[model samples]
Target: MTADLDQGSRTPLVSVLIPAFNHEGFVERCLDSVLEDPYPAKEIVIIDDGSTDHTAERIAQWVAAHGSEIPVEFVRRENRGIAATLNELAARSHGEFLRIGASDDYLLPGGLQAQVGYLLSHRNKGAVIGDSIVIDGEGNRLHDSGMCDLHGADKRLYDSSDGIRRAVIGHWAIGGPVTLLRKSVLETVARWTEGLRIDDWDMFLRLAARDAIGFIDVTVCAYRLHGANFSKTRHTATRIVNLTESREVAMSRVCLFDEPYRTLLRAQAQFIAAKIAFLQRRHTRVALHLATYASLLLLSKLRLHRTAHVHAEGA
Candidate 1:
């Protein structure tokens, strides 16, 4: 009983860093969800990134109402992008464990405590992430596992560290909000890469290279799938830019990997190019890029299989 009580008392502080944009109607729920989490030691650090709507106003109201209840550091700032806002929030946070989440999304009950505990026990992991429940704009349950429904990934792939790392360039099933990271690891990666709308991809790619990421088979967040969600926009130009940025980010990290993995990353870049070409109605370019992408991926797979077979025989 004494040891259990001591462990409970020693629960590390988790900084729930939220970057708020124009999520006026949803910011309060996001704040409330943090409070709802059963974690004993936690703080809220939120920055409104130049929201044109009443998001800042809602944040102000929530802080006013709940300031005395918890440690809250709230700021209303000019319109910088998400990456910039996340960097500022990370700098402001002073917690042993950090969770950077979207203001439009909410953390589930006990999620903070569970993730923190997982990291405490798993010394090999610098960051721990879990699945998220995908919900509609009206808060209706769309899918229990965002990894499966939204990310189009095999959920079981997240069961192992190697699986998650391989998926970094292949599937990208990790959710940004559900990840609980150590301050040291975030600092090691130098935090979010600014000047890119597709920022998290670059950061995670860096994390994967360092083998600093882990996963838990739990649903810890509500990933709201509203029309305005970053990856859901129908605007053709925005899609093109996002795809291009993704390719650039992947290409930048190829130096960290060797032969097969490097080829896989390059193949992913080519796949993204094919997507962009299709969007631009350059069917010929799409065909060419797709062919090269497929060929590179197949070669990588064959080499990987051969290596695995040799290792098995050696063993």
Candidate 2:
């Protein structure tokens, strides 16, 4: 376990912070993946966030069997939302780097090493997001690169902080469970906001504003696709609440930008509101939001294109 694999230096310990929910059938696989990872310097922190099912029991069972493999800290508590649970997990961790794991997902071979390496070399980056191998609930290979299916994300956008900001504002996909964050950077961004069912997008927006996030194309985790996945919620009311929350998060970041980017963020929020309106069958409101959204979106795109063209010519 070297700091730089190429240099055979010290390996920085990674705190794997996993906040679990009702994932009884899958939590063991998640723990197994963390254990299977070859990176030697590690600290595992798993919290079963008030799961109604036997998720906490399953986690307990796994810990009892394998806790001695490394430094493991397990906690089972009343259900708080994901964001609060994540914050608590980070607080309990002591690693230089942190990998936020989902109890329903598992990591890939060499994934942690690659992510750590990237952050070490790019000190300006707060976190590095890697790709995920998409799989079904049964562990059947659904395909590869879950981000592609989930976000249709452009790999190149990850190359520049500006591009990532654009992608986030433009509602482009930035996918995965393989994001490894520097503990300091997390502190820089003030940690995750509590009470939000959706957290990653908000956190990434803040990180990108500080030019702290980057993307790696390597597959780092097995992202299980089950019906219960938050993004795939079947209930209408739950979906609306999530959408409303996400829209608020996007809107909250609009003040951090200028010109086209500010407009882009607003447009994205407006687009989300349009979807919410459609869901509520508010046809007139939906039509109005859609028209405004389309115009703002198109205007931002044209301005952004012009800016990029000038930059490319070194103007």
Best by TM-score: 1
Clashing pairs in 2: 3-9, 3-10, 126-212
Q: What lDDT is reached at residue 236 by model 2?
A: 81
**What are the per-residue Cα lDDT tens digits for candidate 2 across 1-315?**
112355565689999999999999999999999999998889899998899999999989888999889789999999889889999999999999999899999999899988888888887888888888888889999878676776687767767777888877775465547789999987678889987777888888888777788777888898888888745666788889989998999889888777678888889888899889998999999999989999998999888888889889995
Give the residue spans of candidate 1 off by over 4 A: 1-9, 230-232, 313-315
* C-alpha positional error of residue 124 in candidate 1 after TM-score superposition, expressed in Å: 1.8
For all candidates, the clash counts are 0, 3
Off by over 4 Å in 2: 1-4, 230-232, 305-315
Assess candidate 2 and give its lDDT. 0.85
Report the lDDT tens digits of candidate 1 across residue range 43-158: 99999988999999999999999999899999887888988888888889889889978898999987787788778877677888888998888899998898988879886666
Q: What lDDT does the true structure give each of the candidates?
A: 0.85, 0.85
